[model samples]
Target chain A: MIRLGRKHLFEDLPRFFASLGGIVFAVQLVVVQLGIFFGFVHSSSLLIQESRADFWAAAKEMQYLEITLPVPYSWIAKARAVTGVAEVQPIIIRSIVFENSNGALDYGRVVGFDPAGSLVHLDDHPVGDLREIAKPGAFAADAGQLSSLGVSGIGAEGTIRTKKAHLVALVHDTQPIISPTFLYTSLRNAVLWSPAMIDEFVRDPFTSSFDINSPLNFVLVKAKPGVDLVALRGALERALPNSRVLTKAEMIDVTQRFWVKRTNVGFILGLCAALGILVGMVVVAQILYTSVNEHIREYGTLKALGIPDRLLYASIIWQAVVMGLIGFIPGLLLGLAVAGYAQNARGIAIEITLPITLEVLGLSIAMCVVAAVFAVRRAMTIDPMIVFKA
Target chain B: MNEPRAVIGDSIVMTYPSAAGPVHVLRGANIHADRGEIVLVDGPSGSGKTTLLSILGGILTPASGRVTIEGTDVTRMPRRERACLRLARLGFVFQGFNLLRALTARENIELPLQALGIRRAERLKMIDALLERLGLADKGARRPAQLSGGEQQRVAIARALAGGPVVVLADEPTASLDRENGAEVMKLLCELARERETSVLIASHDQRIAPFADRIVSLVDGRC
Candidate 1:
C-alpha cells in the first residue's frame, strides 16, 4: 500500500496540484489573519521590551500601563534601599496636545524621568546623555513623534506647549510604543514647567503627594543577580498596599491580555480566521470526493487486478495529501507576503515569525489529511464486482 | 489436444437482487478449455454469457455449485483470497479496453506486473517485451487518449499477459474495433495463447471470431 501510495502521488501530482488553487487561497486567508492578530498582540506589549526594566511596581488592580494609577515617587527610594536593588527609576506619565508646525493637533503621552534614570534611555543605544536632558529647556522627541510632528534633523526644535519645554534632540528609535509622538524630559524640568503640580500635591496631605494631576505612573526597578524575584515581589506587595508588584515577564503578559485578549478586536479577527480554515477544508473535501467518484472505474479496474482496498484507499489519500502540500507551500509564502505588505501599509506592528509560519504549514497539512480521510473512505468502499457487470 | 488446463464450473447457480425480485443470471452454465485452446461463449443479450464468464473467472460468486481453475476451488475461497488467485492465475481483457486514461501504453501494460509486486527492473523488462510482441513498441509512451481504439484494445491484452497468468478471459475484446483491427487483435490473443500454452475463454456475440475458437458454448435464457 505504501509503494502504491508513492506511485499514485508521482503519477498524478501535477493534475492534483493544478486543481487546488481555491483551497490554498482559503487557507492563506486564515493564516494571514491569525498572523496579523498575533502582531497586534505583540504591539500592545512593545512597551515592556522598550522599557528594559527588570520589574514594574504600579497601583494595585492595574489593567493596562496607560490606565494604571501612579505610585509614590518615594517608593523609588524605598525600593533602592532593598539589599539586591541595582537601580530604581521613577516615570511620570500624562497626556497632552501635540501641535505640529502646520497647526495640526494630536494627543500624545508626555513622559517625565530623572536625567540619570535607566528607564528613560534604552540600554542598547543611548539617544541623549543625562547631562543633555538636565539642561534647562532641553527635551528629546522620539523619532516617531519627529516625523508625525513634521520636525526634521537632530537639533530639531519643537515645543511641548502645555508644559512649555523645548525639544532639543531627535532620538531615533522608530518603536511605536515609545516613540509615537511622545515628549521625554528630565523630572526637574517637568516640575519647573508646571510648578502648580508640586503645590497641588503638597496641599493635599491626606492624599499621597505623588497622586497629583501629573502623578508618577510606574517605578522601574532593576534587581541584582541571585535575588529571588518571587520573594522580592511578595515583600514589595506587603509594603506598598496600594500598588501591585510584577516581574517584567508578568507585566508584558498583562499588557497583552489587556489590549488583545480582553478586547473585541481579537475575537473578531480570530473568528474570521477560523471560518477561513473551515471553508478551505470543505473545498478540499468536495474536490477530492468528486474526483474519486469520477475515477470509480479506474479504482475498480485496479481492484480487479488484485490491488487491495487498502491500496486503493491509500491512492486516494495520497492524491489529497499531494494536493494539500502543493497548495500549502504557496499559501504559506503568500500569507506571509500579504502580512508584510499590510504591516507596511498600515504601519501596524504585525509579527510574522518563522515559528508561526511553520506552525501554520503543519496545521494546513493536518487539515488536508483530515479532508482526505473523508474522500478516501468513499473511494475504498466501492465494490470491485462492479467492473465485471456488463 | 493437451490436458484441460481450465476446468468448467460444476452446476453453478447465481442469483442477483433486482427491484422486482431475485433475478437469476446464470443457471448451471458449464465451460471447459484445454491448454492453448480457445473457447468461445456466444449468446444473445441478457442470456448470461458474460455472467457465466464472470463466474468462471472468479469475479462473481455463485449461490450454489463450484468453479475450479487448475484444481483450485475459487468458489470456496474468501473474497480477497479469490481475488489474489485471479490476479496470480487469471487474466481479463475488458469489453471497453478499460485503460487508465492518465497512463501511457507502457505504463498501463506494466500495471498488472506492478500489482504482482514484480521488481521495477523486471516489470520494465516484461513490459518492453510485451509491447514489442504486440507490435506496439512505438506507442508505449502514448496515453489511451492519444491511441486509436484498436491500439487501446491491444494495450489491454498486453496488460492481461504481463503477469503471465495461466488463463485469459476476454469479454467482447474487439467490440469497438473495425474488422481489420479486430482480426489483428484476435490474432494476437490466439498467438499468445498458443505460444505460452495459456487457456483462452472469449465471450462474444461476434460471429466473425467463431471460426477461431476451438470450442463454442452456446447459451440461451441464462442456461447453457
Candidate 2:
C-alpha cells in the first residue's frame, strides 16, 4: 500500500542496478536471438517465398530450395498435361565458380530461369530487368555480392566455369543463407557452364551423361483460376512419380524446417535465448532473496505487528515488476541498435517488428515476476517471533 | 468498577524440542493487564520474559494456553482473523526499534494504520497527530539510520500508538538505549498509554524504570 516494494528495491542502489543489469542482459539476449532466428528463417526461404508459382515440382529427395537434385527436364511435359495446370517451366540452380577480369576466383550459386516463364518474381523489392539475363553469357547478381563474387558492377566481365560471362543486371534482398551468392542467368548458360556439369562433360565426352537438355533442378507450375492447388499438386505428384510436388506454402515450410529443425544454428541460438532467461531469473532471485534476508528483522516486526501476508508478498512481487519494466527499455533499445548493425554492416537480417518488441517486453516482465517467487517464499518463512528476541 | 481487563494469558505453556528433549520455556505462566495500566514483566535472561510477552501479543502460540485481547480469544481464532484483530486492537514495540530502514519515520508509522485499511487522508491526519504528540513531528521525514537512539525509539512509540490500539506490547523497548534515553522513553510511553487508555505491557530487566509501572510481575524458573 505504501509502495514498500519499490522502496525496498531502491534502498540499495548498487544491488538495484545490478538487478536491472541482469534484466537488461536477459531482454537483449532474448530479443536478439529471436530477431536473428526470424531473420534467418526469412532469409533461408526467400527464393521460395518470393517466387510467383502456384507449386514446385522438385526431385524426390529435395528437402529445401537450396539443395535440390536434378529432375528430368522431360518431366515438364508430364506436369503441363496435368488437369488444372496452366503452364510449367524448368529451372536450374547449381554451384558455379566465377573468375573476374582480375582473375579473382570465388564461388556462387547460379539460378537459371527462362524470362518467358512467370515463375521468378521480384516485384516486392523491385530489381533490374529479368530480360537482361536472357542474353547469352549474361547474368544478374545482387549488388551486395560484388566483393564476394569477385565482380565489379554491371558490365563487369567474368568467367563462369572457363566460359565468358557478364554481369548484366543487379537485384536486391535476394541473398541466400545456404549459398554464398545467387547469380541469375538463362538456363542454357547455367546448364552449359556450371562447374560440376562441365567436369562430367569433359570426363565422358562420348557419352550422353552430360546432356544439357536433361538436367533441371525444379519444374515451376502455374494453376488455372478456380483450381484447388492441392488437388493439382496431388495430380502432379501422381503423374511425375520421381518428383516431389509442393505448394508454395509447403515449399516455404520445408525450407524453414530445414534450417530451424535440421541445422545446429537454430538450436544454439535458441539455447542462448533460454539461458538468458535463466540468467535473468537467477540474478533477480538472488537480489530479492538477499534483500529479504537483510530486511528479515523488519519484515518480522511487521508480521508481529499484524501485517497481512498478502500485502507482504505483494511488495516483493511489485519490486520484480518494477525492475522488469525499468530494465527492459534500454535492453530493447540496445537490441534494436544491434539489429541495425547486423542489417547494415554485415548484410545479415535481424528484424525487430512490433510483435517482436511486444513479445520481448512480455517475456521480460514474466521472467522477473517468476524470479520474485523465490524471494516471496523466503519472506513467508520468516518467523514473527524473531522480532520479539532482544 | 475496576478497570476492564484488556489482555490476559491464562496458563500459557511454550516448549521447544531439542536433542535433550522438550525444553519448556514458559510453563503455565499467567498474566493480565487492565486498560490504561502499565505492567512490567521482569526476569533474568532465558526466564521467559519475552515468551510471555510473545504469547500475550499472539505472536507465539503456547503449547496449551488461552490468550485473550480485548475480549477476543486470539488462540482459538483463525490465523487471518487473529491477524486482523491484532491489527485493529493491538500494537507491538521491539528492542531494536525495528522500523523499516527504507521508509521515513512518518511512513513507518503509517504502515500498520494502512494495514488496518484506514483511508489515506484519515491515516495522514492520525499520523500527524501521533507524530506531534510523540514529539517527532519535525523529525518524521528522517529514516531510522538518521535518527538518534532516543529519537528512533520515539518514532517506534509513535508507530505503536498510531492505530489507537486497545493494548500495546513492548519487548525490552529501552534495551538498546542509554540510561538517559531509556528513562525518557519509559516516561513518554507511560504518559501516552495513560492518555490513550491503552494497556501497556513491557518486558524488561531494567530496574531503574520500574517506578513507571502500575504493577510489576517477576518471573523465575519459567513461573510467575
True contacts kept of each: 0.37, 0.80
| Docking level for model 2 | medium
lDDT accuracy of residue B206 in candidate 2: 87
Q: Which model scores highest in lDDT? A: 2
Global lDDT of each candidate: 0.74, 0.85
Error of 1 at A212 (Å): 6.2
- What lDDT tens digits, residue by residue, belong to model 2 across residues B117-186? 8999999999888888878889989999999999999999988888989999998989999999999999
Backbone clash pairs for candidate 1 read none
Which ten residues in a row are the worst by lDDT in model 2 chain B?
A: B1-10
lDDT of 1 by residue, A104-211 (tens): 665666667886766655334545453576777676765445556666645554455544455666554434432245666677666554333444342222343445
> What TM-score goes with each of the models?
0.81, 0.89
TM-score of chain B of each: 0.95, 0.96
Model 2 clash tally? 0
Give the winner by DockQ. 2
Which residue window of length 10 is worst by lDDT in model 1 chain A?
A: A199-208
